[model samples]
Target: MILLGERQILKVVRFATIGAYLGDEDDQVLLPKKYVPSTLCIDDEIDVFIYRDSKDRLVATTEKPKLTLGTIALLKVSQITDIGAFMDWGLEKDLLLPFREQTIKVEEGNEYMVGLYIDKSDRLCATMHTYEILSGESPYDVDDMVEGMIYSIKKDVGIFVAVDRRYHGMLPISEALRIYKRGDMIKARVVEKDEEGKLKLSLRLKPLEQIDKDSYTILKEIEKQGGFLALNDSSEPDEIRKQLSMSKKSFKKGLGRLLREEKVELKEDGISLKKL
Candidate 1:
């Protein structure tokens, strides 16, 4: 059976006119001219995405998709109007992002990582605020390490995150040690639940002592690599954390200890082992 507003892998079954209707089931949905891929034949299985047209009519398309329906996608804003902004979703018509539907009005040429869905009007739309769509049980718990896409930031409040795009979490101000703006992806930890029941997240992991078992592994890498590692202070905090999984303060402390013992020499570019 063919499902509306969904992509289905269907066998061509037969050939039809430019505006001819076709479907595997009796519903016999219309395959508009725009949806037809060049030169097709029967019994050939092809992937097609289905959606309602401007007139609220069912239609199909073979356009390379940015995302499947019901799933969230980071789309680019193509145009903006007083009414709304249109996002390029690899379709003949751009998806509408109504003003009321947006967390913030996005300007053209900007990209917004958003959750896409069909609104009450059956029109495809997007929203930066996805708490309503992502509220529920998390496949994670306190102290659990997780990675997420930075969708948006509410200044002074924190950043909104979609953990693996399946769970909801927030990086609070106190624990956001590093400066991060929207679209800056990050690694975080599930810290606790807020009074409002939202997930309280922390960008900083627990103290290194908490990862005692892994400390030996890290120390070994430092030793094998010559007791020293060079890193530019100009590197973004997020990038540094990605490389070392530790905050700048924590990393500096460790480096200082190694240098004080003459185990390593701080160089102009980075750190290197002291040659006796």
Candidate 2:
């Protein structure tokens, strides 16, 4: 069977003005004349990538696409049409990313990570829903800093990442102070190896800024408890974990920042939100 969106070697069964017809007796796709090699003859085998043309006809090419089925790549948008956005994927026909499959409002000339798939009409298309499509086997350990692209956003879940543009990784909502948008470049560290082997990433990698992340968590918790947390730096480690879900050392560091910033005040009993 001919596999769309993948490279395969096929036989040159016949010749035509348009190009060579490649495949066995069951199926054939035209390898356009411009891409045809010199001294090529009937029954010669050539490696080719298969995709449909603008006319929706299956065609073969010697050129490789930046992405293929079940995998992802960062592609640049060429233009935006009413139907979808077109991207340059190193093919004669610009790849189509239909609006419905987009995770965000794509702007012309912006790059987005997308995966290839065959649509319902049997046409090749690109999609931004790549959370499950990314490869999970990554060479990273806990606290190893890595850079990636934010490929998808799962509301109330987390930020889906493509580390080094291939491995599956994610930043949980609790690990962030703000929501990261799709197509955003991410520089973070691996915090845990998830049960499924995917990387659980965290942005609190730098020692200098690590307090910021913990401090934000404390501020939110204090505000959630009506501007007061009975747990303070003097509190026991178990109490800090029970009340704030953080270590006592982290609590002290974050509390110190809040005190320095005057967002909260240390009191005789506990920490209180400073009045505006």
Candidate 3:
């Protein structure tokens, strides 16, 4: 049976002016003319993503959405109605987030992390209760780098992520190298597990990896500023972040490396490049 809100490979049963009908066991959905492959023919199988159209009928498209059944994503609220909220999931049909599915009331023009699921009425909907659906069963270990999508952020806790769009992970505020928003895709390294066994992530690169990056940044900055920068190891953390977009510790390390190489000299007020 063809499932909604998922990608399925189905054989083309027939063709029409509008498009090709793909199905198995009498269940079919229209692959719109625009989405139908130019070389597609009857009885030929094509892979397509399935979702309900604006009219609430199952339709097939070659386009893929950011979120699908059993998956969680950060979606923006496009409109709010008395019944519920509509989110733009990059498809013709806006995914619905029914009031019952929302953990909290949502507002228009804001993004929230939501889970995609078919409701009781057989209609695809978005739900904000995403914690229940994330799989903590990740095959990862400390210091392992993984890619993930940011779904939510809490100032007190950290940024929530869906590792590989399946396993759960979080970038703690302490390890966050920069600000991130919902829907941001980032690469992070696993630090350790929290008390609850959830993955703790760090956005900063490993020490050696970061040193090279920081060194490059410092060199580029000195070049940009005509071979001088008004920052030293004693500079405030916030000042370092503003000037170099790096941590105070990283800036000091990079500066120390430059000094040891005789590439720069420490001044009472700041640091200056050494003569070539």
Candidate 4:
């Protein structure tokens, strides 16, 4: 049986003004006239990708799609409709990225990595949930520096990464210097490999102590809030996370460092930067 979203070599069965019909007559698809080779004849086998056109008719094209079924690629958004965003995937018909399949809000002209899959309707579509399609068997080992794109972010959980756009990796939230958004490029070191060989990533440029990193985050936040913050060790855990997006334990570590260094002053209600 022929498959959609895949390249197949089909035999030319007959010709018509519209184009050549490929495959057995009982189950043939059209290769538009523009794509038909002038010298092509019946019984000739040609490679093409099969997909439904704008009119929802099965068609064959010599044009190679950038992404195929079960594979992921960085596709550009060509247009947006109420149904979904259409992405340019090197085909005449843009692939739909249904709103339900989006991991983040997509905008036109921006490129995002997506996996191709046939939806419930059997039409080819793109999905930002690429974790289900990426492989964990990467060619990376511990301490290897690799670049990845943030495909999904779970608060208090790690950011799901697509390593080099093909492998699975995770950048734990505790290791993050700050909050990250989906589709952002990340550079990290492979700290460990999971049982499945997926990478555990660390954002630290060097293997510095986690406390020092945590302290840096607090310091930055204090500075960002104009030399003071309305939270401290006494603040509720929820309040700490509300303001810092970090656990109270981590915040205290950062706060303790700043106090020991005389970088800030703790008060009854808040902490203030130590003004020189």
* Alpha carbon deviation, residue 75, candidate 2 (Å): 1.4
lDDT of each: 0.68, 0.86, 0.86, 0.85
Q: TM-score rank, highest first?
A: 3, 1, 2, 4
- Encode model 4's per-residue lDDT on 147-232: one tens digit a residue: 98787788768888888767899988776656677778888899999889899998764534657887788888889999888997
Question: Compared with the true structure, what per-residue lDDT tens digits does model 1 show for residues 1-276?
Answer: 666556787766555666545666555666666666667665556677887666777777776667555445678999998888988888777888888888776889988876667788766677766666564366677888888777667887878887766467788765665567665667777889655445678765576653442333335556776665546455566765676666666666666555566666767776666787
Q: What lDDT is reached at residue 30 by model 4?
A: 94
RMSD of each: 6.3, 11.1, 2.9, 9.6
| TM-scores, all models, native as reference | 0.61, 0.56, 0.84, 0.54
Q: Could you tell me the lDDT of residue 128 within candidate 2?
A: 84
Candidate 2 lDDT trough over 10 residues, lowest sum: 174-183
Give me the candidate number with maximum TM-score.
Answer: 3
Instruction: Flag regions of model 4 displaced more than 4 Å.
Output: 135-276
List runs of model 2 lying over 4 Å from the truth. Answer: 135-276
lDDT of 4: 0.85
